[model samples]
Target: MAPTPFESLDDYISLPRIEALALSPDGTQAVLTVAVLKKDATAYERSLWTVPSDGSGAPRRLTRSAKGEAGAAFTARGDILFVSARPDADGEADDESGQLWLLPAGGGEARAVTRLAGGASQIAAVAEAADRLVIGAELLPGADSLEADAKLRALRKEKKVSAILHDAYPVRFWDHDLGPAEPHLLAIDLDTLEDTVAAVVAESDALATAAAAADTETDGATDAPADAGTPYPVTLPRPRDLTPAAHRTVDPDQVAVSPDGATVVASLQISEQRGGRFALVSIDVDSGERTTLFDEGDVDHEAPAMSHDGTRIAYLRSPRSTPEGPADVEVWTAGIDGSSPRRLAAGWDRWPTSLTFDRDDGALIATADSDGRGPVYRIPLDGSAPLQLTSDDFTYTHVAVDRFTGDLVALRSSWIAPPHPVRIGRDGAVAPLASPAPLPAAPATIGEVEATAEDGAPVRAWLLLPEGASDAAPAPLLLWIHGGPLSSWNAWSWRWNPLLAVARGYAVLLPDPALSTGYGLEFIARGWNSWGGKPYTDLMAITDAAVARPDIDETRTAAMGGSFGGYMANWVAGHTDRFRAIVTHASLWALDQFAGTTDSSVYWQRIFTPEAMTEHSPHRFVRDIRTPLLVIHGDRDYRVPIGESLRLWSELAEHHAAADGSTVHRFLYYPDENHWVLKPQHAVVWYQTVFAFLDEQLHGGEWHRPELLG
Candidate 1:
C-alpha cells in the first residue's frame, strides 16, 4: 500500500488546481485561476497566475494559452480581464465563443480584447472607478447587430441547426443546451476599447477590399462578400445591449459594475411559465436604460454587490420557498438608484457563499456555510453580529475584497487542501500565497464526525481515515451523500473526493444531513418537502456517529449519493438492508417523474406539493430493494436527468430480477459524461468504478470489471 496521489488516478488527475481569484483594484495583485491537467489527459487547462497581494511575491505564470485562460477580472485600467477561447496572439478567428483577453497593466502580449460573435461571454462587472466593463454575452435575439449576430451564427453553422426554440422554462442546463442564444448584459467601453484598436486595422483593410470586390462582381467565388455580411467584430467597443432576452438569463453570477462606471447592476431572469425568479436590474451604462432595480414578485434579487463609493447596492434577498419552510436569505443594501432598500445581515443566520463590498463599503465580505466551515464573514452594515473570517478548516472561494488592503483575496480549500492562494488579513490573518500548486499530500485522515438528531437535531460528518484504521483493522464505511440537499460537507471537492475512498481501504462518511446548507433556515426546514424525512434521519444519524468510530466498519456499510445524494442513494436502497452496496450518482428516482423532468423544477415547483412531490419518493421505495445497487449515470445528465438514471435502471429491472436475465444491479453508463464525470478519462473511470464496486461489496473481493467497463 505504498501508492500516494491518493492511490494514483493518474497521480490524482495531475493535481494543480486554484480555480479563481482576481482582486487588484490596487489592492496590489492577484489573478490566480490555475487549473492544469492538459497534455491530452482530455481537458482542464486554464492558465493565468500572479499572486502578490502583499504577501510580497512568488506565484507568477500569468496567461499562457492553448485556449486556456479563465474569467479573471481587474480592469479599472490595471488591465487583466481574461476569459478565453484563445487563438489570436494576433491570429484571430478561432471560435467556440470565449474571447475578451487583455493582460496589460503596463505589460504586453495578451491581446484579443473581444472579437465576440457570441463570445466575450463572461467578465460581468469590472468598473470600480470606471473605464467600464460588463460583458455577459450570447446574443442573436432577432440579430440587430454584431453582424446580425454573425449572420445568425452563420445560419446555425450553415444549417446543421441544432434546434432550440424554447420560449422558456429552462430548456436544458446541467449539461448545456440552454438556448439559441440569450444572456446579454454587455456594456464594454474601456476608453472605447482603446479607441477600437485602429478599428481593427481598418476592419482588416475593408475585408481586403471586400474580397477583391467579390472577385470582380461575381465573375468567380462567393461565400458572402460584396460588402461583407458576417464580418462584424470591429475588435472592441460594441457591446452595449444589457439583457435583451430572446429568452431570459442575465444572472451572470448576478452582475455588478457601477463604481462610477454609470451602473450595470443585475440578476434579471424573470420568466415564470413554471420556474424563474431573479429580478434586480439597473443598466443605463450609457443609455441601454433598463431600471427595475429589485423587482419583487416571489423575490430573488441575487448576489449583486456594487458599492465602492459609487453609492451602495449589495443584494441577495431570495424569498420563494414554501410548502412550510426554507426562506430567509436577506442581506440587501440598495441606493445606487436602487434607492433606500436596507436589511444588511438583518438576522443573518448564514447561507451566503459569497458577496463582497468591504474595504470601505464599511462591511460585508460574506462567504457563509459555517460549522463544517466555509468561513470568511464580517457582515456589519449596522445590523451587526457576523465577524467570523477564516478560522481554519478552509472552503472560502474566489472572494476578493482588498479595496486597497482592507485585505482578502481568497480561494481556500480543505478536506485537506486542494485549491490554494491566500492573503486574508484585516485581522483574520491567513497569509500563505506562493502557489503554482503546492499542498498535495492529504490522502486521508480528516476527522470531525458527530450526530444526535432524532429530532434533537445536530448531525455532522467528514471522517476519511485511511493510512491504517484502528481497533483491529476496521475501515469500511463510505456513506457520502451531499448534493445540495442544500449543500454542505463544506468544500474541496474535485467532484467528490474522499481521497479516493481513503485510498481504497474505504472509510468515507462526509454527511451534514437534514437538508444541510451550513445548517439554518431551521436546518432547512428539517428536510423540507420531507426528503425521505429529515434528510434520511440526518443520514442515519450521521451514519450512526460514523459507526461509533473505532476506526469504523459497522459490519462494512456503504451508501453513496449524487443529486440530493442521488436521492439519498435511492432512499438508502429502499430503506436499509444494512448496506453491502448501493452507489446511485445523478439520482432522484421518480418524484412524480422528477417534477416535470428536472433542469428547472422551479425550486421544486415553489416548495413542493404535488402531494409534497410524491411524498418523499425514491420511486415509492422501488419494491423495497434489498441492496446491491451501484447505478451511476451521465448520458448527458441535464441535472439529475438521464431520465433519472434511466428510471433507476428500469426499476432495478423491475425489482432486482434474477431468473436468468440476472441483476445484482450495476448500470454505470456514461455516454459522454455530464452531471459530473468531467473527462480526465471520465474521472479515471469514476474512481475505477467506485473502487470496483467497493471491492465487490465490502471485500468479498473478486468481480473486478472496470476496464473501461467493456
Candidate 2:
C-alpha cells in the first residue's frame, strides 16, 4: 500500500500556547504571558497578558517588546506585575536581569518597578500587607577557584585528571580562575520600592579562598601528588557556618514565612551522600534559633504550608521505601511540635508544584499532575473527596490559588501545543482566559485512537489525518513519541504544527506506550527495565497496527521524539529498518555513557537496575543501526548534556559510513536551546528543520523551511 504524505508541518507552528497563569487578589482577574517565536531565529517575545476569571473579556496584552516577559503575579491593588528582559539587554541571552514592571490589571503600559542586576528568581506578597513584595535573587553559586576544585574532583573520578602530571588535557583548560556563583538569594523589600541586600544566604568566600590557596599549593598540577591530603580542602565552610553560630542555613527551597510573617520555616539538606534528605525547620530570623520540625531521610519532601491556625503543617512527602520501586508520594500533615504525623489524601503525581488553603472553605487547594499532565485538584483539610477541578489533554506547568476567594488558576499545554491560560469555574466549566492572540482553530478531522501493543496492552494515542486524505489511498504516516519515559502524551494539543502536518498530507500518531505515567503506577514502570524491550516493541507494533489500517501507508512511515522519545528513536533506527526517516532530539543515545556522565546516576541506576547498564544500552548495539537519522541536541543542556548526542553522531558516522554516500547521519546542535526547545524562535527553527528533514526523506521533495518567528 502507498503511504500518505503530510501536507506541511508549518501550519501548526502558529498555534497559541498558554503559560504562567496567576490570579489576582480579588479573584476577578488573572495575569499570564503568551510567547511566540520570532522569525529571525532570535528569541521568543512574550508580552504580559491578562484575562478575566469569568472568561468574559478577551486576553489582553500588557507589554510590547522584541524581548520577552515571564513569571507574573497580581498585586494587592489588582495591578499586574511581571518581569521582562530586553533583547539587546544581553544579546538575546534572556539571562539579562529582569526588570520588574507593573501594569493596570485592566491593561495599560507597563512601567519598570525595579532595575535588577542578574535576574529575579521568585516573588511573593506579604499576607495582609499591601504594597509589600518579597523577592528572591539568584546570584552565581561560588567563585571560579572553588568551582575548579569541584570540577577537578569530578575529573579525577573520570580519569580526565590523571595522577601523573604529563597525562592531563592541559593547564589552560584547567586554570583555576575563581568568581562568585551566579545566583545567591536575597530578600527584596518591595514596599520601599527600593532594594536592600537583606542577608547573604550563602557565603562562599571561605570556600573559594580555601580552594584558591589549595590550588596555589598544588602549583597547577592536574592531580594531587601522593603527599597531597584532603583533596584540596574539599570540606569548605557551609553557608550556615558563615552565620553567627545561632543562625543556621535554611534550606533554600524551603524559605517560607509564617502566616503572621513572624517566623521563617526553611528546609535544608545537610548531606546528599549520607541519605540525609531535606529537613523542615523553623528559623527565628529575630533570635536565630534554628529548630527542626521534621527531617526527611532517604525520601523527598518540600513545599511545606502552615495550617490556617499555624498549629499544623502540610507538606508533600515521597516516603523512603525499601530499594524496590518508587515510593508513593502523598500529602502529609504534622503538628507544629513534630508529633501526630498524618498522611493526607494527596497522590504522587509530582511534587507539590503549588499549594494553597481556602480560608472560607477550609479546603486544601493543590495543583498536582497526579494524572500525568498537571491539573488543579482540591481536597478538604479534613480529607474529603479529592476532586479534580480541571481536565484536559494538557499538563498544568504552573498553578496558583487564592485562599480567601477560592480562585483556581493554571497554565496548561500538551505535546503539540503552546501554553494558554484556562480558568476552572466554580460550576466546573473549563474556560479559556482572553488569549492575547487568536488560537489556531482545531481542524475538523483531528481526533485520538488507541493501538494495542504486541503484548495486547492498550496504548492510548492521538491521530491527526491529513486535510485532504481519502480512504481510497493509504496516506503517509508520522509517528511521534514523548520524552519522559514516565511522561504521557495527551489527546488535547495546541502547538498546531501537527495540524500543519496533516495539512501537508500526512497523518500524525502519538501513542502512549506502557511507560507513560497517566495510566497509573504499574503502567509507568512497564518501560523501566524494558527501555528497548517492551516500549520499543510496543511502539513498533503500534506502528504496524496503525499502518495496517486502510488509511495509512506503511512504507512511507517516519518517526520523531525528544528526550526519552529521542532515546527510543535512536533505539528504533538501530533495531529496525522500517522508518524512512527519524528525528531524535535531546536524546540519550548511550545508556552506558549516561550511567557515568549523567548527574542523576544514582537515580538512573535505581530505575534501570544495575544489570541494565551492561545489557540494554544502545551504545553496545550501535552496530545494528541502518535508518537515515537526524540527531538534535542543545549545547547548554545541564540535564542530558550535548555529549550524548555527539556520541551518537560519531558512532553513526563510524558505522553507517556514507562512503556509501548516503545522508544517513546528520547532527544539529542548538547552542542556546535546553532539553526542550522552550524559546519561541528556537521552537520554530526546531519544527522547520524537523519538517524539512522529513519532507526531504519521506516525500523526496524540497520545501521552504519555516522560521519560528515571523
Candidate 3:
C-alpha cells in the first residue's frame, strides 16, 4: 500500500485510537475499546473490538452504536459485557445515561441487562459468578429503588431546578459539577433477571390488553399491534448499596471483586481533619460489613488488586503531599483476612502505575515509570529484587495478565506512536498485535538529549527534529514542557503533539526537569515547595543543552507549556528574555488564589500557604516579562481554573500598554473546552494558532490570525 500518505492535522485527529485492553479468563481472547471520531466530528464514539490473544486473526468489531460502548469485560462463560447509552428496543423508559448490556458468547444480539435510574458508569463482573456484577451509578440523597430515583429526577426537571446543596468539602470535580447526586456502588445479580423478565412480560400484556379495549371504544384510534414481539423488559433487582448511607459521600476511585464474588475491595476517600484520606477497605458482599484493610493517616492507598486464588490483596501506598517533602510509592500486599501485610519491591525507585498478580507463581507484575519510560516489572512476592521487563521508551497501561498462560496484554504508546495493543511473553519479548486501526508513520526523527542540571542532577529530554533539519539549514527550536509537574514526558500526547510542531518545521524539546516522575522521590522533593527555584533552573539548563545542537537554531527559540508546565512558562517569561515568544495554557498565575479556587483545593492548600504564594507565584514577577506571550485557557478548566489565565492576561495587558502599545500578547479562550482541548476542530485550531504566533515572532513574518477564529 503506497507508503501511507503523510498525516495531516485532520488525519492525526481522526485516527482511531485504542483506550484500554483486557484479556479473557481462559487467555484465548482479548478485547479493547477503539475510539473514533464521529461522522459530524463533534466527538469521539468508542466501540468494543475483540481479537484472538495469539494474534492469529484480525480484530473484529464487537459493539457498534451511535453512543458506542465502553468498560468491556468477558464473563466467566465467555460472554461479553459492556456499558453503553443505546436505547433499549422494548423502550420502557430510556435515558441518555449508560446502561449494562450483555452479548452472548454463542453469537446473538446483545440484550439490555440493567436499566438503573441514574445510569451505570462502570461495571465489573465477578470472575467466579458470571451472572453477578458490581456497578457504580449516581444516586439522589434519599432515593432507594430505580422508580423512586426516577421520580425525584422528574420532579427536579419539572421544577426547572439544577442547584445542588452540598454539605461537604468538594462540591465540584474537574471540569464538571459533582452533585445533585452522589456516586454510589451497587451489586446486581444477573441470574435473577429471569423473574424480572416474567414480571415485565405480564405488565406488557396488561398494557396491551388495555390499549386494545380502548381501541374498541374509540373506533380503532388506540389500537395496539397484534403481532408485537415479546417485550424483554428487564426489571433490575434492588441493588445493594456497597458504600452505604453513612459513607454515601465517599466516592471510590478503584474497586475490585474477589474471585469467589463474596468480597469487594475498594479505595474509598474518607474525610479527615486535614482535607481527606484514601483507604483500602474490604466489604463483605453479603453482610455489607466494611473492614479497613489498610489506612495510614498520612499516606493514601489506591489501586487494589486481588489475587486469582483470593488469598491476598495488593495495593499501592504513597504518602500524602505535605509542605515538607514529596513522597515515593510502594506496592504493599496483605492477606485476605487483613493480616501479615508486607511491602513488595521495598527498594524500588520507580512508582508502579498499575498492579496485577501472576496466576502461576503469584509474583507481582506491575507497570511503573522508570527512567522517562513506563515499563513493566515483575516483583516476586517473596521480597526478592524486582526484575525489569519490556525495556523501551514507551508507556504501557491497562495491563491484563492471562491467568492460564501468564501472557500479558497492554496498550502501549511512545513518542512516535499512538496507543496500540501488544502482547508480551513471560521472557520479556514484545510482539505487536494486529491493530484494528493502524497508526500513520512518525512525522519526524525522535532522539534524546541528556544534560546536567544546575545542582548536578541529570536531566533528560526527548528532541523531535523536523525532517530536513541539518547543520546547513537549522530548524528553530520550541521548548515544550509537560504538565503534572510530577509527570514525566514519557508517553505520546494526543493534545500537545510534538509531531504537529515538527510538521511546521520546528524542532521540539520535551524536557523532564525537577518534580518530573520516573526520577524517584528525591528529584520531586528538589522542587516540591519551591517550584521556581530548582525546577526552573533545571529546565533552563536542559534548554541550553538542546539549543546547542548543530541542527537547532539557538537564537530563534520559543517556549510553551500547559498546567504546571504552563506555570513554568509564565515564570520563564518574567525571568528571561531568551525566547522570542511563549505560550502558556491553563497556567497558575496568583498561587494564593489558585490554591483556594482550584478543583482540588485541599490538595494544593496542604503545601501552598499564603506566604509561599507571595514568594513563588508568577504574578509577583509579571512586570518583568518582556517577551511576546500567548495566553490560552478554557472556562471549564477547574483544575487550574480560568481565573489564573484571566489574571495573567490582565497583568500582561497592563504591562504591555505601559511599556509600549505593542500588541505582542494575545489570549485564546475556549468557553466549552476543559483543561485539554478535546474537540477535534478545537485542537486543530489550537495548533494552527500556536504555529501562526510562532511564525510571526521567530521568523519575523507578518502576523496572521488563524482563519478558524473569525
Candidate 4:
C-alpha cells in the first residue's frame, strides 16, 4: 500500500491523539484515552480505548460520550474505572463536574458510582484492596458533607458573588483561580457502595425526579416511596479527609496507597512561602493521622510509589536552586518505617520524570531526559549503577511495566511522528503496538547539529530540513526556542510544534541552551539568574552553526519562542538585528513586574531581587530592538500573565513610530485562551497568523491578516 500523504494544516490539527496509558494488573489489557475533534471541528473530545498488551489484535474503542472521559485505571478485580461528566441513564442533563464511573469486568454498561456535590477530579484504586478507592474532590471552606457543599455552592451562585477573599500567598494557578474551592483527598469504600449503586441504577428516573424536587425544597430533604418498589434506602459512608485542616489550603501533586490500603502517601506543598517546595506525608486511611515520611528544608520530594509488599517507598528528590547554582535530582528509597534512607543513581546526570517499582520490588524502572531524548532506565534497589534500557532519538512518557509478561509499554514520539504506544523489550528493542489511529508519514527529514558554547560546554540541537532543499535552493531558517528554560527539547510537543514550520518550507532549529536539563547541573548554572547572558550567547552560537549548513538560508532567518523562550526572543531582538523577524508569545518583558504579578509571585520573588530584575529584564533594552516583531498572548495566562505582552506591544509600537527604519510590529490577542491555545480552531488560527507574519517579514510578501480575526 502507498504511504499516507502529508496534507494541509487542517490534516495535521485533525489527527487523533492518545495519552495517559493504564495497564491492567494481569497485563493482558491496556487502556488509553484518545482525543479527536468533534463533528463540528470546534474542539476535541476524549474517549476511552483499549488494546491487547501482547499486540495480538488492533485497538478498539471502549466508551463513548459527548462529555468525554479520562483518568482510566484498572481495579484489582480487572474492572475499568474512569471519570466522566456524562448524564445519568435516565436522560437527565449532564453535570458540569466530573463523576466516577465503573465498567465491570463481566462487560456491562458503565454506571456512576459517586454522587458527590463537587464530583470527582482524580482517582486511584488500591493495589491490594479490590473494593477501596481514593478520590480527589473540591470543597468549600467549612463544608464537610456533600449535601452541605452543594447548598453552599447554590447560595453563592444565587447571590451572584464571584469574589474570593484571600488571606494566604497564591491566589491563582496556571490558568484558573484557586480560591473559592480547594482540593482534598477522600477515601471511599467501594464494597459498601455496591448496594447503593444497584438501587440508583434500578430507579434512576425516580431518583432524578426526587433530586429536581429537592433543589426547590428549602429543608434539603427528599421524599421517598414507602413500598417494596421504592428504592432501597441508599446511605453512603462518610469519606475521610486525609489532609490536615492547616494544610487543606495547599494542593497535592500525587497520591499513592499502601498495599494493605491502610495508609496513603501524598506529595503536597507544605510551605506557603517557598515556590514548589513539596514533602511526602503518610496518612492513615481510616484515622486520618498524618506522619512526615520525608521532609527537607532545602530539597523537594515528589512522585511517591509504594512497593507491592508495603515494605518500601521510593520517590524523587532535588535540592532547591540558589542564585549561584543549579541542583541535580536523585532517586531515594526508604523503608515504610522511615529507616535506612539512601539515594540511588546519585552519579547519573539524567533526571527522572516518572518512576514505578517492578513487580517483585527488586528494582525501579523510570523515564528520564538524556541528551536530546527521554529514555528508560533500570535502577536496582541494592544501590548498584543504573542501566540504560532504551537508546533512541525519540521521547517516551507514561511508562508502564506489564507484571504478567515483564514487558514495558510507553507512549513514544519523535520529530518525525506523533505519540503512539509501543512495547520495549529487555534488550531496548521497540515494536509499535496495534494502533487504530496511526499518524501520517513525515514530510521532512530531521538531523542533529552540535556546537561549543562560550564556556566550552557542549550545546546540541535538532535541525529539521525541508524534503527537497539542497545547496542550490536553501530553505529559510527559523530558530525556535523551547519553554521551561528548565526543560529539554527531548519530547514531542503539541503546542510549539516544529513540523508546522518545516511543512512551510523552513528549516527549524531546536536548541538546548545553558538552562536546559538532561545536561549536568553545571550547564544549568551557567544561565541561572542570568537569562540573557550565557543562554543568549549559546543560542546565537548554535544558530550560527546550523545556518552555516549548505541547505539553510542564513540571510532570511527568524527567531520565535514562548514563555522563557519568548523572553529570549525579546532578548535576541535587543541584542542582534541579524534575524529578519521575531515572534514572542506569553513572554516576560519587565522582570520586576512579572515577579510581582505572576501566579506564583512569592516563588519568583525568592529567586529574583529588584537589582537582579533591573539587570536581566528585557524591557530595559526595548529601545535597542531594530527587527520586525510579532507579539501573541492569551489574556487568561497567569504563569507569565498577559500584562507582559501588553507592555511589550505598547513599547514596540512606540519604538516603531519613532524609529526611521522599517520595523513593523503586530499583536495577536486571544481573549479566552490560557497559556495554550487548546481549541482546535484556535490552534489553526495561531499557526496561520504566525506564518503570515513570517512570510511578510522574510519573503517580502504583502501583509495579509487571517480572515478569522476579521
Local distance difference test, per candidate?
0.79, 0.61, 0.82, 0.81
Residue-level lDDT of model 2, residues 200-313, one tens digit each, is 212234445555766676455655543232222112111111113111123344555554544555555544541246677765543556687877557666677766555666
lDDT rank order = 3, 4, 1, 2
Give the poorly placed runs of model 3, Cα more than 4 Å off: 1-7, 92-94, 128-130, 195-199, 203-238, 246-252, 658-662
Task: Estimate, for each residue in 608-634, the C-alpha lDDT of model 3 and write its tens digit.
Answer: 555776799999898899899999999
Error of 1 at 651 (Å): 21
lDDT of 1 by residue, 1-710 (tens): 54678778888988878788887778787888888898878888889888787777688897777779888888877888888887764434556568787778989777776776678767877887778788777876767667667756766787778877776567887898787788777777767655356876887886776557545654323354322453554555667776665366665777887777877777877777776788877778777778787777887878888778878888888887898888888887878788878886667687786788788787878888977888888888887777886788888888887765587878788887777878888899897887788887776778788888899987878888888899899888888888877878878888888887887777787888877888678888877888898788878888888888777879999888888888888888888898889888888888877777888776776788788788678888788888888888888888778888887788778877877878877888888888888888888887888788788878888888878768
How many Å off is the CA of 460 in candidate 1?
A: 2.9
Q: Model 4 segments beyond 4 Å from truth?
A: 1-7, 90-94, 195-238, 244-252, 274-276, 658-663
Clashes, model 4: 0
Error of 3 at 186 (Å): 0.8
How close to the true structure is residue 183 of candidate 3, measured as C-alpha lDDT?
78
TM-score of 1: 0.32
Worst 10 residues of 4 by lDDT: 224-233
lDDT of 2: 0.61
TM-score of each: 0.32, 0.76, 0.94, 0.93
Candidate 4 local lDDT, 105-202, one digit each (tens): 88989987776667788785455544677888887775555556666666677678888887676778899987677888878776765545666565
